[model samples]
Structures are given as C-alpha cells and as structure tokens.
Target: MKIVVGSKNPAKIRAVKDVFNECKVSSKDVPSDVSNQPYSDQETRQGAINRAKACIGIGEIESFGIGLEGGVMYIGKQLYLCNWGALVTPDEKIYTASGARIPLPKSISDELQLGKELGDVIDVFTKKKDVRQNEGTIGIFTNALVTRQEMFSHVVRLLKGQWEFAYKN
Candidate 1:
C-alpha cells in the first residue's frame, strides 16, 4: 500500500510510521506545505485537507495522503488547550484529538497572547531552547514523562484504522 505524508517533521513522520507499522501497512513521505493559520477548527482541518489534496496531484499512484496540524486555544477564563488535526486522502476524512487543557500561569500565558507559541513560553519556563522538538513536555518540565510522540499516539492509532480497509485490497 502507498501513503504520502504531508511534512518532514520527525515527530509527525514517526507517529505516522508507528501507526502503519501497527497495522502492518507501509507508506512514504512526500514533502508538502500545510497552512499554519489558526483560524477556526475547520481552518485547522483545512490545513490537513489541502495537503491531502496536494498529494493527489502526483498522479497514477495508488496511495493515501495524510496531513497533520496542531494548535492551541484558551477556554473560559482558566484553561489553555492544544489540539491536533489529521486528514486522510481521497475520501477527505478528518480526525482530531483534544489535548490537555492545562492552565498556564498568568504570567506565562499573557506572554503567549503577545504572539509567542507555547513552546517558546515553555522554553522560558524550563530555561531551555526548543524543548518541544527535543524532550517535549516530558523532558523539560514537570515530572510527567510524556513525550510529544506519546501524547499523539492516539492520533496514530486512529490512522491505523484507516489502513485496514484501504490495505485489504
């Protein structure tokens, strides 16, 4: 079976591979740009949609395209949250995961509103640079030993479900 993944991000790629591996299906990565816009939830979903659309342009190939986009949100007055969006090809299906809505300290969250991403704020808190790519939330902060891959594993599992029917010939 053939699959095209949208980005070159190691974590994103790894998660995709883990899912296919679980289902005993194989895939490939075809680099493409997905939107970074944080509009509405649908916009986030569209980011993934565009990638799957882009990959289909490759032509005459039997495969699926996958796209992933992640973002953050503030809920009520006390909670901060993150989400990951995924898209699968041809059928243009979508799946999303609602991440932990851990409330940021006011000082840190206020900084985020000024345009900094959560990783930057997290870096400042941990006194490290780009921990999101390295140790993720688990490595640099708190006693929680969860890497980004671990957090997104559920997303991976969902993708595996798609491969079943697709790979069945």
Candidate 2:
C-alpha cells in the first residue's frame, strides 16, 4: 500500500513511516498547506477530514491524511495544551487520538496570549533548543523520563492499532 501523509512535521511523518515500514506498506510525505484550524474537538476532527478529502481530490495513489491540531483546555484554574491528532485514509476509515495534556501555569497562559506556543515559553524558561520538537516540554521538564521519540511512538502505536499486527508482515 502507498500512503500520503498530510503534515510536513518530521516527527509525525516519521511515526507514520515507521508503522508503514513495519506493515510492508510504502509511504510518502505530501504536506497540505491547510491552516489547521481547530475551534472545537469536532472541528479539529473536521480539519483532519478536510486534509484527507483534499488529498483525495488531488489524485489517486493509496493516500492517507494525517493532521495534528493543538488546542487549549481549561481544567479548574489551570490551562493545558491538547495535542489532538487524526489519520484519514481513502478507505474513509479514521484513527484519532485526544492527545496528551500539558498543564500550564496561569502566568504561562498570560504569556501565550501574546502569541507563543508552550514549547517557545518552555524554551524561554529553560533556555533549551527546539524543546517542543525534540524533548518536548514534558520530556525536558520531567528529567527526560520520556523522550519525544518515545512519546511519538506511543501515540503512533495507539493510533496504529495493535503493535503485533502492524509489525508482522
């Protein structure tokens, strides 16, 4: 099978590729210039659906569209980042994850209103580099308890279904 992934982010693409490789399916990166608007949880799902629809409208070549939309959620007095993701294939089958939550302080939320993501703020506070892409805030602040690769793999495994089924050709 040939799959077309929708995002250009290396981590996400890599996750999809890893699963495909194990499944003996080929894959390719085909970034969609979509704005990735995620107003509501349902709309976030629509964003993924839109990407898949767009990819299919473009051509036919065993395709899958993957999209990650980050959003803010309030729990009590704290704010958190929700990294929701979805995978849509031409089969119309969809795989989605609600994403992990990254709790943030009120001060951080105030700073984010000025236009900065959690990673940027974390980097500023910790003096780290591309903290979101690599270690991520959780990984770095948690003493490397979980690397970004590990997290990505975990989520990918969750979204990709059974590990044994995916890996066994």
Candidate 3:
C-alpha cells in the first residue's frame, strides 16, 4: 500500500508511518486552502480534508492520502490547541479524527489573537526555533508527555479504526 501525506513535515509523516505500518509512505506539499491559523474546529477539519483530497493519486500512484492540521479553538472563553487528521482512501472514502486538546496560556492566546500562526507564536514564546518540526506545542505544554507526532499518531489510529468499522459494516 502507498500512502501520500500532504505536508513534508517530519512529525506528520512520522505519525502516518507509525499508524499505517508496512506501507510505502511519501509526502507532497499541498495547500490547506484555509487560514494559516484556523480558529475553529470546522476550519481545522476542512484544512485537513482539503489537503488529503488534493494529494490523492498524485504521480499516478494508487495511494491513500493523509492530511494533518493543527489549529486553535476558543471554548468557554479559553483558547485551546487542537489537532486534526484526515485520511482519503482509494475507494473515495474519507475519514477524520481529532487529538487531545489543552487550553493555551493567556500570553500565547494573546499573540494568536493578533493573527499569527501557532508555530510562529510557539517558537517566539518558547524561545526555540523550528518547534513545529520537533516536539511542537503539545510537547512544550505537556512537558514532552505527549509530542506533536504522538498527538497526530493518536488521531491517525482513530482514523484507522473508523476505516475498519466502516468496511466491517
């Protein structure tokens, strides 16, 4: 089986590989077709779905396409980080899942309110470069208990379950 991921980000690619074992995995840069910083669950899911569909069948390879997107949402007057993953199978079926979420500190939320991507804001706030390619905000917040790759991996696992259930029924 061949799997194509929307982004070349190592974390996302690694998550896919971990969940979809024994598959030929490759990545392509594709547009999310949404705001760089999505502020709602609907937008975040849409971005993931868009990327997954956009990369389908690229290079004339019959492949499953995966898209992973991280964003923030405002719930109960608190801002929380959210991660979403999407899978597009060769049979034209789409599945999606979400990872764990935690409220961001007020300081980071303030910066995000100014229209900054979470990665950039996290990089500046954490005083670390390229955090997205590494542990990510989840890692920083959870003290490495749960990393970006792990978060996406969790979602991918759920997506796989969904696929199994759908086909089983």
Among these predictions, the greatest TM-score belongs to 3
> How well is each residue in 1-169 modelled by candidate 3, as lDDT tens digits?
7889999899999999998888888999999999999999999999999999988888646898889999999999999999998999887799998899999999999999888889999999889998998999999999999999999999999988998799899
Per-candidate clashes come to 0, 0, 0
Considering only N, C-alpha and C atoms within 3 Å, which residue pairs clash in candidate 2? none
Candidate 1 regions off by >4 Å? Answer: 22-43, 57-60, 91-100, 137-144, 162-169
TM-score of 3: 0.97
Model 2 has how many clashing residue pairs? 0
Error of 3 at 162 (Å): 1.0
Which portions of model 2 miss their true places by more than 4 Å? 23-60, 162-169
lDDT tens readout by residue for model 2, 1-169: 4455555555656666676674433234444333332334556555554544455423455655555544555677676655555666666666776556667666767877676666667788778777766776557645788655555555566666632344465
TM-score of 1: 0.69
